[model samples]
Target: MAFKHKSTLLILTAGVFSCTPAWAASVSVVGLFKDKAIVSIDGGRPRTLSVGQTVQGVKLVAADSGSASFDVDGKRRTLGMGQSFAGGAQPGARQSVSLTADARGHFAAAGSLNGYPMTFLVDTGATSIAISAAEAKRIGLDYKAGEVTGVGTAAGVVPAWRVKFNTVKVGGITVSQVDGMVVETGLSVPLLGMSFLNRMEMRRDGQTMTLTQRY
Candidate 1:
């Protein structure tokens, strides 16, 4: 009788441990709304969660149409739509940058071009990254030596040079061999265009824009 009781206790303890759910290793916000969010855990199917609800160790703390806050494995993380969190990521992991829109609803990013500090205005309309002649000179770029070209602008056709940047970094995300253009005139700020944006997974939520490196 004593041996049977001990065996039963051990089996019950094993069963309890086996029933416990494993902690989630990854979480992605796919949808957000007032007091609700849709999240995917470990690349699984999306799960809809209300504020204060928990799923796969991820608890929704707060949510809105633009962003969502969650308690992920005891860490509070705010994520916009299409943003993700990877638990236990090692150093030098994948990079992502988040930008808030200005009062005028325009997005600007502070980054570097070939190690030179530059301010970039997010412009999806531009075909390539566009910089002014003066900016190129300030960055010590020999833009005139690049292939001569013409770019149309509000001020009409303007002389331009096609150049390839060795490195274009926006926040922690860095892209190499990015195509760009140097306009002789009619350009005020450097434009972050398709040349760089194409290499990123762009996500916009209300006034916030998130750029995640794809490679």
Candidate 2:
């Protein structure tokens, strides 16, 4: 009788193991364009899909430059660049900001520098966050006290001052002790450059760009 009970228990354990479900595929939006989106399934290589197209059970319903809508497991969802969906579970809390491109494809946002409100033009080509001398003065920045330097501009190499900012905040994201440069001339608006961008994971879809803090 004991042998019979042990056999039944082993069979039940095996049945339970056989009924367990396989791991659900994880889908992430890595790129988005007009009527098309690039997605990674199960953390695999990115695959591009057009509207109404399906790949690995994930379907793209509609897509624009800024956002994309999809059908997953019979659920309709919309996501911006860098967002993801997995096993019907929502993404975790992460510091991220989204920017919409203008008609000219320029991405800009309203942010603060050292707690002062300002506008920033996203310029990936720039090496550091750049501020104009006039704007710095208006914000009560003692730019002249920083190290004197030269920054190349459209006009030519122009006078500049290298400084550090206490904080740079954009939307809900904030970075501390960011490197910056105050251009003495030839810069009309502040440029958000690699100094800040290097610490962010950038994702662009059509007219939408997402910046997620990495550190």
Candidate 3:
């Protein structure tokens, strides 16, 4: 028993001593409302995060001035107000990024909104951006997953459910915590509703799409 205890102590000591400089530390930040910022880590090690990059297991500390930072391998990388760290790396940092595609106007891009992969079909006629029953189910939505509720359609009352999106981004525009609806009437297509379109400047022409927004 004494030998076992000594071995356990040694193992614990190694664990504590082996904490890597790359292991991120706890970070704190102050952010301003309506302000935005970008951050880099590990002295910007990877150099840059390209467009449409998915990131998790990362940290972002926001401040009142729209600046933020995260810990990298036991170090803190702070950002300034209105600064951009989205596409490029800083000195001695690991690469991180947000997934943003560049499609404008009435175009389609596959993305994970609300933590689910979906094909967004740009539509101006949709009252709000909408989704099909099949696509909604993949994102853990309750089409058949929950009790059906009433939804009004051009035909009449149809069944629908209130849904939530964990993340929503299009052409560099993003919003979170948005309330959405899942409809079941044999919708062959997932409609890109206004809930997303109202957030951007979309211009469409013959076979071309243009989208513009302020980052």
Which candidate's lDDT is highest? Answer: 1
Best by TM-score: 1
- Tens digits of lDDT, candidate 3, 71-125: 3433446556434332222455442212222323224533346644344555555
Task: Flag regions of model 2 displaced more than 4 Å.
Answer: 1-92
Per-model TM values vs. the true structure: 0.58, 0.57, 0.44
What would you estimate as the lDDT of candidate 2? 0.69
**Candidate 2, position 4, lDDT:** 6
What TM-score, to 2 decimals, does candidate 1 have? 0.58
Q: Give the Cα RMSD of candidate 1.
A: 22.5
Give the alpha-carbon lDDT of every model. Answer: 0.71, 0.69, 0.42
Model 2 agreement with the true structure over 193-215: per-residue lDDT tens digits: 88899999988888788887788
Which parts of model 3 are misplaced by more than 4 Å? 1-106, 142-149, 152-156
Residue 119 lDDT in candidate 2: 60
lDDT of 1 by residue, 1-215 (tens): 00000010111111111001123245678899999999865444467999999765678999999999989768899999999886642365556667777665667766678866665777887767888899899989999999998877666677889899998866556689998998887777678888899988888888878887788
Stretch of 10 with least lDDT, candidate 1: 1-10
